[model samples]
Target: MSVPAVETAPLLNTPLYDLHLRLGARMVPFAGYAMPVQYPAGLLKEHLHTRAAAGLFDVSHMGQVALRAADVTEAARALEALVPADILGLKPGRQRYGLLTDARGGILDDLMVANLGDRLVLVVNAANKAADLAHLRAGLPDSVAVEELPRALLALQGPGAEAALARLAPEVAAMRFMDARVFDILGAACLVTRSGYTGEDGFEISTPEDAAAPIAEALLADPAVLPIGLGARDSLRLEAGLCLHGSDIDTTTSPVEAGLGWAISPARRRGGARPGGFPGAERILAEMEAGPARRRVGLLPEGRVPVRAGAALFAEGGETAIGHVTSGGFGPSLGAPVAMGYLPAGLAASGTRVFAEVRGQRLAAAVAPLPFVPAGFKRG
Candidate 1:
């Protein structure tokens, strides 16, 4: 019997669609949106430019939500029930990484939670936005209001980000990593966060949809800034060793095993103020203390060939599979192929040798320290 073709929803366009075309970007469907995957400069050039200079990315497809309540603390506590984070302890004008966990302790999505004084704003992956909205509405009390923001988000990333941004809003020069502040850009209010997926010093700016194009144009006018697309964005994040929710992590992966235990706040851990309340707390806490059966680790392939996702990993010269590649690709920054995968804790140590099955060949790979490139965040 002929297999039936699966129907797909029509792709949506972000506010910068026209600008992307003007800049000769190759549009591709991602997360139900038509986003630019690369520009005329090609993926290699874009990736390197972002590392050496500022690269502006149109990330308007990301989900931005505002959680409001008469008392911000009340909303924080309400959100804390669904995530293993200490939202109550998150101070205003700051943002923290968080994971939405399932009842089984698997990750639902990874998000950035920022305290914007009057409310908590979350930036979640675009693919999970609908589910995240429904999740908040179902879990939060009536007192908490879950409102989606119609905003266009842009990321200006690289070692040169601050200088380029400071030209528009001079105050951004003083903002350190993870610091969130509100500023006006060319008469439009924009929420600026000193954070990004790339392990570089940068800012994610949330601006009104109507003003996005003008602000992007202003920044692009700077010689240091180039209009980057999703292709470079992915390779950049891969080099940084940051997990992509559906790939490096998923519904079956726990935060502890994903090398994200650091996202769990000390206040929410065992013996802390409020413990064992969040979803999957029992399994997650147990994994935190005893460690998981497998852990996420970085891998370096022996040759120039890439060991992509889904490649089964094996012990050196062994037949049985021990793990699988979660995410993998060439590292433009390192001039080599790099990958990340889950492996038994005993074999997860750096320098440990393993073999990845590719094209009927068993290629040797070595476990390496994460973040093929060093982080450039201005953490104080």
Candidate 2:
């Protein structure tokens, strides 16, 4: 999807705005920020480079919020009331994906919750940060304080991320997926997490805003690490079957319907030890057991035509619409067009044939497993 153009001026800029311009980046408005959509190498090259080596991405527009209380247990329990994850059981220095939901079991936003020893750090979506902060403050007790950190976030992703990052912070090489730690790189303190959105072996570094440029430049100095922009980032995550906040998921999609039920811990499920204390727990838990009417599924279009978002889906040989694509694009790694959208439960199985209406033509598509390109996460 192309980044939307801004009609008005005065959009927020990240600390790397100057550096982006210097690198010949194509700037565009996204989530109220003038972010780099692509560099001179373009999205295709950037995407391919990340898959083969590493790509350094400036993701400072994302929100970094910290929750603190007298103890970690107290803070985790308070946070559990708002999200469906089992925060209280989260181990120290570990992170987990979670969803902030509404009372009706719809997703408000998806976020990353990391147990930062004495406190919890939340990485929320840029577009929903204000609302997510407000929600966090309103849900937590007085003892649990929610504070947004004035920091810049960077992601070093793909297969070569480990080698590039280890050159600066050698200890980071020991950490597995979802592990987090504080490290000093070039005398600058940074909180590094072994996680990212691209379904690759990578790390996300959160540092003081003032150090953003220096850190980014240091990472890009490596031959294997090239600066990546938002265009490739969106395509990478899309090919990984990850949901975009406002597009693939929103206030109307439930975690179960989105095929993110694994994010809801077993301990928080019905009949578990700490069952159903979050918002929409009743409906969420009920759906967990009974199943949702429709579910998100991966679609592999038969031909080279790329199906885009909002394209209607239809049943075989029937004009009646079954669903619509939420995120669709060409998967450079898979060498084919890939998409994801909601489909009836009965027709969501892999190998189930369907059709997508693109430009008045019904193109044949097949229901396939998610992550059009296999994930390369370092689980151990």
Candidate 3:
């Protein structure tokens, strides 16, 4: 089922909105835009198809921003002040995952930062792009320019993505994970990155807005490429244990507590040259030294029933609620129910038995390792 729109405000449409309709997509509202929830083939087939072959996703609604300082190094330093990652040390033609943190030590947003040859580019969530833009503008020095890019983003994912994209830009076949470069496709200058949200080997293509439809058309012309929608995207990311902002991690969750400690650069930690500059660095560094009070972990429900978000977690026989599910659904890949939630550090171990309160009944569940499905990134 697709998430419906209830907002009174008029919703926006992406560059591929018309193409989606033409392809028989079941349009639904997501992040204030009319997006496809699934195509004629439906969500289940789309999910399994992506795991086996290839799936094309329209993600143009996401925000694209470019940062420019006097020089590339200056731009990296300017961005380093805002994110936990070591942007100053980032090399050209590479990208890294970063977090925008608030003074309270909570994550404001999760984003991808790429070191373009002359500037740096950031890809932020659609729901938080406005706020993220405002934050960047206000925080960065006046000399630095924070400009939004009007580009369309598309994701081609699965084990076959490499071959599919290589047909158009042969150079992409040699790129490894997190590599970013520019290529000419259909007379358009495109920024191609070897990265994706799905736990599959894939590539994210950022191209001109006007060329989106035809580019999508060209890709769909291939038999292996199927149009996937938000429904399958959600289930795929869940099985991959990827956190969705506003659902799994939010203003109240810290990166350490959210099982994202690795995103923090070592140079930003205590006893380093550039230590303690970012917002909430004090608390974040402290949490690194002494573990957080609670931790995010995976949950496996014993039965076939789907456990959804907001279900409260409890001790097997205890009455008081300890935590609640942040993201949950039936894992199409596993043929079982999977979820993720926060719990006291003591109870966060794998195989720890717990119960979730669902409609007045306690269902048995156990803490499991994250990524119910293993990640298939081409790290080489």
Of the candidates shown, which would achieve the greatest lDDT relative to the real structure? 1
Task: Give the candidate number with the greatest TM-score.
Answer: 1
lDDT of 3 at 341: 95
Q: Any runs in candidate 2 off by more than 4 Å, and if so which?
A: 1-9
The best-first sequence of candidates by TM-score reads 1, 3, 2
* Cα error of candidate 3 at position 88, Å: 0.7
Please write out the lDDT profile of model 1 over residues 153-272, one tens digit for every residue: 999999999999999999999999999999999999999999998899999999999999999999999999999999899989999989999999999999999999998888888998
Task: Provide the overall lDDT of each model, using Cα atoms, as 2-decimal numbers.
Answer: 0.95, 0.93, 0.93
Q: What CA root-mean-square deviation does each model show from the true structure? A: 1.4, 3.4, 3.4
Which tens-of-lDDT digit does each residue in 226-326 have in candidate 2?
99999999899988899998888998889999999999999999878889998899988998999999999999999999999999999998879999999
Residues 137-237, model 3: lDDT tens digits: 99999888999999999999999898888888899998999999999988899999999998999999999999888888999988999999999999999
lDDT of 1: 0.95
Worst 10 residues of 3 by lDDT: 271-280
Question: With candidate 1 superimposed using the best TM-score fit, by how many Å does residue 101's alpha carbon deviate from the native?
Answer: 0.3
Give residue 335's error in model 2 in angstroms: 1.4
Tell me the lDDT of model 2 at 118.
96
Please give the RMSD of candidate 1 to the true structure. Answer: 1.4
Better of 1 and 2 by lDDT: 1
